[model samples]
Target: MSSYAAVLRTPHACRAFAVGLLGRLSYGVVPLALVLAVKEGSGSYAVAGSVMALFGVSGVLLSPVRAGLVDRYGPRRALVPMAGGYAALLVVIAGVCLRGGASGVELCVLAGAAGTCTPPLGPTMRALWSELLPDRRMLETAYSLDGVCEELLFVGGPLLVGALVQYAHPATAIALGAALVLAGTVGMTGSPAVRGMGGGEQAERDGARGAWGAPWRPALVAAGVGVGLGGVDLLVIAFADGQGRPSVVPWLLAALSVGSTVGGLVNGAVRWGGSARGRLAPLAAGLAGALALAGFVPDPYLMAVALALAGLFVAPALTTAYLYADELATPGTRTRAGAWVNTAVNAGSSGSSAAVGLVLGQLPLALCFVLAGVPALGSALAVRASRGARAGVPRPESVTRVDPREPRSTAGR
Candidate 1:
């Protein structure tokens, strides 16, 4: 608690953390909101899934490009327009769906457009964190807290989306999420804390764009994590449907988030001496195993428990993956480096959605769970080839200097 407090003591830190959370809330809520809206409009989960699938693919293609812009031009110059543009897209999407004006082709195009426009706030916000706080322990704590905050968002986001979709409309939830993104980005980029920060140096920016200069390992591992997430999330929803209690879906997801939140808190608070890379694979394997086992559990309540167990290492694994990205990437590409992980996640989302959708239509749910875990395990293995586990967290570059003056202690920036 003290460490957490210490991290948030400065106005800079507090604002960065808050803004990150606000921006990411959209990420947490968007999938369900979009899915339900599309489903209600088209009367087919397949169409909904297809729209989201296309969105994921577009996101994957756009993450690196947008992140590169952030690295080169700075987050404020790069993201503010992005945030607003994405919000506008969401509104358009909602309107189209509500009016039933879009054909399959149009929906696919809109989904792609939305994905391409979607702000990569998660990575950019973390880059801001790296800028605001350069201390090692505090950085760890900040990262963990970020992860924990995301867990908390996931816990609430689904329920919020579900209720809105049921009561008002899916468009309402998505529009609200869009508002959060716009507000968060404007607030974050406009803040003094973020204003002081620069993008990467020219050389680092140049290298980020160069072929063979990418952070391939972290991207690969992140992709695996995405695959795991896509599979596990859909399976859980399936499990609830299978049990004839779709309303319990949020509760089950909340359990998983609780476990992940606990793990993230512990990982940050307890500073044991080990490379961040060392924990990546085993933790991922554990999460994968837990995911697979959960599918076999007959009861929905038991399945929730199983998911909780599986999610225990999730935040830790993800925290380490980012740390590894930091370690592996070139000096100037903070946002771009981490953005690859986001790309991988989007890729996994697209791939897994397609695969899981197929499994849901053709095969048993149990098989879907088993297949989902395999990609993560494979991605973990890929991490090994990239000096993973054996590598330590990256040291800050000597050239990247912090501001001379310190921030005032305050909850509000």
Candidate 2:
């Protein structure tokens, strides 16, 4: 009968909360910033979309390498430099855009740089959660809370940035975003939870070679979910444009975000006694069907409703994926496992954005929605296949385990 509030009072929990806020806030501005920059600098929707797509591409490409760095050097060692570099890159991007004469290629390159150097916030925060929460149920609740925050960012970030860009200036929004990221990242890094990570020199040496054992199957399956959802976002925007209601695109996307937020909240509140894999198939199936229906809906309002329904499964599916990942990751490499999951998500989304953008140009928006569902269906199938193959595998609680060499708390023991 341990109280959640008691756990929350711990330094680790406090750090996790701070890191979560910073990470979500940083991500929230991304889509809005991309749209504003492209519209102002390139003056074309297509170009703007492409620039937005590059943000994902950059994250996808760099995440694994960054994860490896974290595994080798620890979160504090990796995050400190990365956050500083990210802030600098954001400033550079702002400067370039402000100059008003940069070419599309130049902007794209800068965009790529920003994306590549983007702080590994998601991965780092998830790592902090694993280190902080040792109990299974508590860890699950923590991740659910994280998911809810993500939903809030999606709901609020775009609207905030969009308004700023439309009313004030894009630079103003970008500047504010950069400042937030700087402050949040720095503060999180200084916390006891982050500083306490990766203490054993032997484990650190072993982890440097990427020795963290991780289940590739579930990670890959989760990547499909990311790709599918990322494509859905693009489709929403494209659908809005096709219907000549571009102004409504953010709201439409927010519908999905709101649904996800609700779903995460519910998941955190409810206790389910079953396999994570047991929940996977049904949720994936529901998500795929919802996404498919979204494509077929003719009315924008109906489409929004469909998207909201589709989003209901997002956090559950992702949470299951993280659980699967935890089951497979080895000691001293839990953070890398989290990073891999994030990388897969970002990579899938990045690839989908580029592919879906092309498809949207040629096909109808409805068709794009249908196409986007393919990845979700594929993920469902993959999870189903894995469940069949690995029947009755005991799930691990979380990624991190205490080292015997280090002083152990009575609670941890």
Candidate 3:
């Protein structure tokens, strides 16, 4: 708790964090809202799902490129136009949905455009945190807080949209989503702290190899985690629906969220003994084991307990990945580096949904759960093997010394 308090006490930290979360909330709200809106307009669940798939694919594939723009030009210049275009497209989507009789093709085009232009707020805010808190330990705490809050936002955003749709049209939720992102982006980018970052400051620090080199390890781990998580999501739905206890699904998911939130906060507060890089394999293993165990649970209530165990590893793993990415990043490449990990997780999750669905019908559910755990288990072995292969090579220092102009601390790393 003191660590979180220290993080909030940093100058301009609260404002930047607050506004970044605000903008990111749009991500949670828009997906559900847009799905409902498209379904209402097209009168076809198939059309809604296809449009969302296109939107998600476009957003996930192009994330690194957008992050690069922010790195080259700075957040202010890159994010402003991106947010404006995204919000405008969302509004257009809302209008088309509300007008009635809109074609599926038009909605797909608008949704794809909006996704392409979605500002990389999550990455940028994380980069800003690195700049604001040079102390590696403090930075870990900050990332934990960020990850936990993001989890909550996704959970809460749907409830908010659900309430809004009960009274207002589904299109209105999309419009509100547009407004949230626009407002959040404007306020966040205007901060002095964010304005001080990027602008090609250290763009060439790593030469032609680019910022993609060292952080690939963490990105791979993140993707594995994503794969496991995606499988869990689809499997949970199947589990609940198969048992004819649909009402239990939300409780199961909520339990996962609660475990993640507690685990993240604890991970940050404690001063762990080893380097974060060294801890990655064990964390992956923990998640893998928990997931494998989840399949054997006889009922939804017991499965929720197993899921809570798995969720305990979720935030800690991601927070470590982000922290490692930040460590490997140079001044100009921070956002891009983080974005790679960000993209990998999303890509893996998105792809896993389709892959898992095919296996679900043919295989026993227990075996399916074991298969879902394979990715994280593979990640654990990969990280360990890589560490063994590079035993003689010196690892990067855990502590980062910030410029005197920014916040600096000589506390424990």
Candidate 4:
């Protein structure tokens, strides 16, 4: 607990983290709100789902580009306009939905446009954390804390929407989400830490190209993790429905969240002796193994237990990936590098969910679980192979290995 306190105690750390969380909460709120609003306006689930798909696809695919802008222009300049445009689009979307006259095409166009302009708050806040905490251990704690809070916000956002929808139209929630983001972004960018940060366009372009290739390990692992976890929700519901216990689905999902939360906190508190890269593959493997065994559980209760066990590896794997991404990133490319991993995870999740839905009807349930585990296992193998590929190569005499634990200067970054 004190370790986490040490992280918050850093000057300006609390404010930046708080405002970032506030802005990011909209990410949780908007998706469900948009779906409901579009469904209400269009009178069709099909149209709503299609609109969301377009929105998510645009956001996930363009994340790195937006992050590059943040890197090239600095956060203060890049994020403010992005948030403003995004908020304005959300307002337009809410107005269209509430007025009840807009066509499906118009709603889809607005949602996609809003998604394209969606602020890269998560990636940006992570970059800010790196800048604020130069010490590697504390940074690890910060990432864990951030991950857990994010997971909770996602859980809470839906409940908040659930409450709001009882008394007000879903479009109202969309408008509220827009307001939260605009307010949070304005407050966040005004902070001294963000103000002090510089644009890295020139430095990023001048740096060696070789530095760009190294972050693939973390990004790949993150994608694999995303793929493994993405289908769990549907799979768990399927398992429960098969047993005629549909009511248990929510409890099972909550178990996964609880396990992940506990695992993330524990991961940060421990002082592990290895590079984040070295630990990442094993963490992924643990998740893959646990998920593979999930299908063998005999009942919904057992399935919940199995998933909770699997969940233990979830946050730690991702936290390690983010930490590794930071380690691999140059100061100028920090946001872009993290954004790649962010994009990979989201893309993997979206892809896997659709793919899993297609195959679930055709395959045996156990086989489906095994199939879902393959991506993470493949990622673990790729990491090992990459390491072996480099093992035989001789190190340059000019370069010396830096101790992973050493607290170095953050002069340029």
Compared with the true structure, what per-residue lDDT tens digits does model 4 show for residues 357-387? 9999799999889888889989988986785
lDDT digits (tens) for residues 272-381 of candidate 2: 67766667667777887898899888878998899889878889778777766654555466666777777777778768877987877798766777777777788777
Quality of model 3 by C-alpha lDDT: 0.84
Shift of residue 316 alpha carbon in model 3, Å:
0.4
Q: Write the per-residue lDDT of candidate 3 for residues 125-176, one digit (tens) a residue.
A: 8988887776768888899999999999999899999999999989999999
Name the 10 consecutive residues with the lowest summed lDDT in model 4: 389-398
What's the C-alpha lDDT at position 67 in model 3? 89
In terms of TM-score, which candidate is stronger, 1 or 3?
A: 3
Q: Where is model 4 more than 4 Å wrong at Cα?
A: 200-214, 388-413
Clashing pairs in 3: none
TM-score for all predictions?
0.83, 0.82, 0.93, 0.92
Q: Cα lDDT for residue 107, model 2?
A: 71
- Please say which candidate is ahead in TM-score: 2 or 4: 4
Which regions of candidate 2 are displaced past 4 Å? 1-7, 38-54, 103-106, 166-168, 202-214, 234-251, 295-302, 357-371, 387-413
Candidate 1 matches the true fold with a TM-score of: 0.83
